[model samples]
Target chain A: MQGDFYQLLKEQGYVLGMSGQAGVGQALTTATTILAFKYRDGVLVAGDRRATAGNMVMYDRTDKVLEIDRHSVMAIAGVPATAYEMVRILEHSFKYYRRTQLQELSFEGKLRALSKLLKENVPAALAGTGAVVPIFAGYDAEQESAKIYFYDILGAEFEGVEYAVSGSGSPTIRGILHYVNTWGEQPLSAMSEEQAAVQALRLLTSAAEFDSATGGVNREAGLYPVVKLITPNGVTAMADPHLRSLFESNVSKGS
Target chain B: MYEEPYRWVEAVGNRRQYLDAQFAQGSPVVGVSCDQGILLMTMSKGTPKLYEIYDRLALGGMGHPADLEKLRFTLLEMAHVEGFNRSASDVTGSRLIKYGIAPVVKQAFEEVFKAPFIAKLLLGELGQKAGKDGFLTINYDGVFEEKNRYAVLAASSSVEQRMVEYLRPQSCVSLKDAVDLAIHAWAIGDRAQRHTDDTGGDPKDGKGSSDQPVADSQTLMTHIRQCMQGKSIECVLLDRHVAGTSKYRTLGSGELETLLPKDLSSALT
Candidate 1:
């Protein structure tokens, strides 16, 4: 039989939803402000480090952009507890399929797998307790190019042709991306790796400026947003030192 | 119907003999730990005998491909699920063999009404540091043993013992040396199997003559040349130095050429 880790877990009575019925007054920990866009070499994915429960900041160093495999990543932007569980399942499912089937899961198959998980989580999502809106980015080896996909809490998947954004600060970042990609000097897809990273830092800074849930770069704590690049080579996370230097010289100076 | 207990035991013994005969001509797989990581190598006509089981684990087997594939999937599902529910470090080779695979295999073997799995598996786990690597070998009867540093899976216990003896004292520090030693170990097991076939006798009987003589380098080279005529070498490495969660990598032919000695690399063509 084809190895399905998620199914195995389900058979073992492990549920991915909240333990008890979610009450309306319950404040769930949520994370946000994740974005992915096409760049010169491939796709650039970025997520801020802020996780908040209601109006209070729960954590500031959460890694929102998680690498699922060598070529793929899932940038989560909703309930942290639920999104993390989904990411773990995705990571294991991809690997399980590859090992058992002796081939990598097709890009379409991967997209469906995520959609299936979201569909299964419908009960929890509808209760307003555990919703996960995520942006999936990866280099499609078969297509010889990078691709970006975004999903709603109900599992409706859409291809982000140029860019995609999600979370509480999504409206602000989306508007800026559309404006820059349309009338800016160059399109987002034409930007170099360094340029793409700088743009991501500036965008997250702008989101934090306007959104309370969005935590921007904490210069005092030396914590920067998680930035990753998906190229034909593989997914590579931009280090904090590099992000710090880029924010100081390019993004901060320009603003 | 084997209504009597003695009859059931006789039938089980017959099954063992049948399973042994089935694996007589199967290729041997050699696994050794080196500074680079754990290396698994085998010679096959077409179907792959080596596979990546998890991030830090690999499997090499000698048996019917269908049976091996079934066992491989079983291990894969268990490992992935355990890793997801628990953590990566919790998914160890010993746990998979002891808890997951051994029970299923034992039940299948003892059922008497069902056919037993005609496969011998060698599992290698790359540890977090040097000298911590582990290798486990499982038999068709569900018997398994865990060893440190090296292990081998062959057609019969005698051949496996001979290969293990040859590798017991050897230590390799480089990938090239590990590959060379693994090929030699594979040659030893393959030669013993061929010897048993030539005599038209049981492998257990053929072990008597092979026990005293460890083949020299020249003999191993000749045997490797003779047996590798219509086969290709399949090698996989669980490299510790690789920068990723998954360390398993299949060495391609282009890379294998550099690792093999000049004479052996030229002979394959």
Candidate 2:
């Protein structure tokens, strides 16, 4: 029993290694197309709801953007099994630290904790079975502002000052975000919440056009990407109805 | 030597006596379920006596701060680990007391050579609906009881019983009513405790005497007024109406003022 839930799990012999488990990674269910960027109020995080196993669409209603706490969210882009596990550990670790220490974990400490988990999963990641590249967007209460961070499979972390993108469809959306942020009418930070959401939908739609793994939108089934906003208040998920209206008026109408 | 089984039992008995004396001046904690959710209130000289244990759970205790903190951390570790390993819904008050805290506190009490945790803890869990709320109280010796609607923790068993009896029939429909009821119930327990202290009564013997006239409302008001001179009130709620998964929240003084009565609210400032 320790403040670090991950350490406690490890001590209980629940290892995260995937090497000995043969044939498990052959068609691993991998989630794709997660993006985060700064807007007027705070950071906007969006992820397409698609899980792919090789060339097969395994699930369409997967929630890639997970709220870790009141002020933080994690958007995963790789293997769902390992990514979900990491999310569970990170959620408990943050809450456990707060309860035991009588204070919130420092933003730096939180980043380091996630990095440690990824580092510990280095074996699985290196074996090509459990690679999770994730974007973490959170409101730093101490700093009184929102921030974005991206992590690699090897545990390296980098601050995404303007935006960060991940998964198989990232290249397509990444180019569009760069072009828009640099030469469009306004940079990403100046956009409002609605504009930022619209841009995210547009980016995912373009990625879906180019990448086979990103499920941009399913109008008949009313399935849209998960979009959440991290502001000074807290993280709030955009409801499907709101997303539907935004997509219809802004993205689907080709305006 | 404690090597002998009888000596070990004697030592454990002595530890219980020591603990009872230590809690002589400790304040009482009152918790009641209302339409809003579960409300926990306590009067403290300085240190906070209420805490948010988990997403749907809150805690109140009467004991040494250090011991309470030790147990709080233990419970927190267990809860988060269980919640992470299993799910949040699986981490209930009874499970936490039965499987997590009770064993640790019991071991410490029985060890004889080891210092026991001198804390009496009350945990409240907000259920999915109004009628399903649960409360559990754990004594220093790790004996616990699962209760419904309301629970109270006092320095002695007699005082706890009196407080429970006073609050047994009261049903609160709003946060204000719940706060009001809890305060009065707390005053009952505190008044009895002070009576015992004044007379040097042995708490273990349940000598706080039932015939001792229950303080009238005016007398209770005066007692609470005098006690509030140097103490602060700690109030927490597990709001079922909250938007997120975590329902635990601390009521700030500003909100407490609204919920508390005119004179009591003014006395706090």
Candidate 3:
């Protein structure tokens, strides 16, 4: 209606007759398990590498973690197509704001924008065609620390106190993270960056054990979980070699 | 020269003259990209006109204020559409110039119904890769050129010549050095401007600055302070090797004061 890209696409006669309600009639390959929390220095954000369509494992090396901007990341846990679209829109809007305004969006500003986007997709989400929930993690410049936010299907934003998890496998993953972060002598709030990363990998591994939709590291195919560290220094993904070594060590340690 | 139809040639000629007159009045804007990052400086005529086009891109121009505003809105909208159509992270300085900006300026010139933009645009982009920062200057008739080390926009022939001499061998200058160089070049231009009768013709005003005498460094410093006073003189930076969250930022007036040499800075009101 308004001369946006979508409108341009329609005017150019690339018409998909389905209503423009977002993610209608698209094959839904759902990704699972994203957990984020504050660590000693910054935030540790991790996602398991699996996507499924009902009983079929559609993808084994899918990337559920996405970089939203310089200081933030979004981990998706619903229809992969819908989530990807949401991520692209958010990225464009954020970059547009920065370019025109000459400043990064405040942490609260980002939350509001994402919430609005999810709210707009409520139609498709309710119709069971485009349900997308994402966990947001970022280094809050004003607060001077890492913070995480969770969202429901209706886009109600909730701040995570110690840690947060989402996806079909989230219930299992959340339980494991809560236990590891709260029940130990050195819980998540007290863990170093290295320890937090290790715990994230362990949580994903534990989630895959019970949740059929979730997948742990695939050693034969050299596929590993995506783990990112968001700090004042910037975002850095854990290398495959390091992930492999960490997985081996964690598995070798008998429970 | 390409032959033009007789009917519109007079109109085109008149437009050229009008634009040339406009350029004569605008203050010189200068920028440099070095190892430290990129520095863009422009003389403030009152309101701030510089815009950050993206995380690593910023733009400033001197021309008709209305035309500048129109260009800003159009360019920003086009870039937003481009970002939406593709991945945002992939949108870089080169991509924006090659795909979005150049074409739009070209359109303005080629279309008869559209008046040629009477502005000089200076664009600075932080290097996406190591040692790849870029600076670009675009003229009114849609002529665009990329500069490696330094670039100047909206300067007179006399001032441009002086700038060419000052900014030679523009390699690996520190951020503070780059800012200093920009200021010095602008001062030379401003000093030369005082000798000319019509140097201060405000493109915005039908008339424009008084014919002042030549300035020494102290007088030049004073003049710079006076012009920049009470204005939000903005500076855009693209830092390399900095672990900070944002390599791009707009430095405030206080932060800018810290970057100036101690002697010139001490006299700031």
Best model per lDDT? 1
Best by TM-score: 1
TM-score of the A chain in candidate 3: the value is: 0.89
- TM-score per candidate: 0.96, 0.95, 0.77
lDDT by residue (tens digit), candidate 2, B96-138: 8998999999998898878899999999999999989999999
Instruction: Give candidate 1 regions above 4 Å deviation.
Output: A19-22, A253-255, B1-5, B208-212
User: If the candidates were sorted by their DockQ against the true structure, best first, what order would they fall in?
Assistant: 1, 2, 3
Clashing pairs in 3: none
Return the clash pairs for model 2, or none.
Answer: none
Tens digits of lDDT, candidate 3, B66-172: 88877776677755666666644665656666666677777776566677777778888787664677787777777777877777774444455556566785454
The reply for model 2, stretches above 4 Å from the true place, is A20-25, B1-12
Ranking 2 against 3 by lDDT, winner? 2
DockQ per candidate, 2 decimals: 0.84, 0.66, 0.46
**How does model 2 fare in lDDT?**
0.89
For candidate 3, the per-residue lDDT at A217 reads: 78
Model 2: DockQ vs. true structure: 0.66
Can you list the residue pairs that collide in candidate 1?
A: none
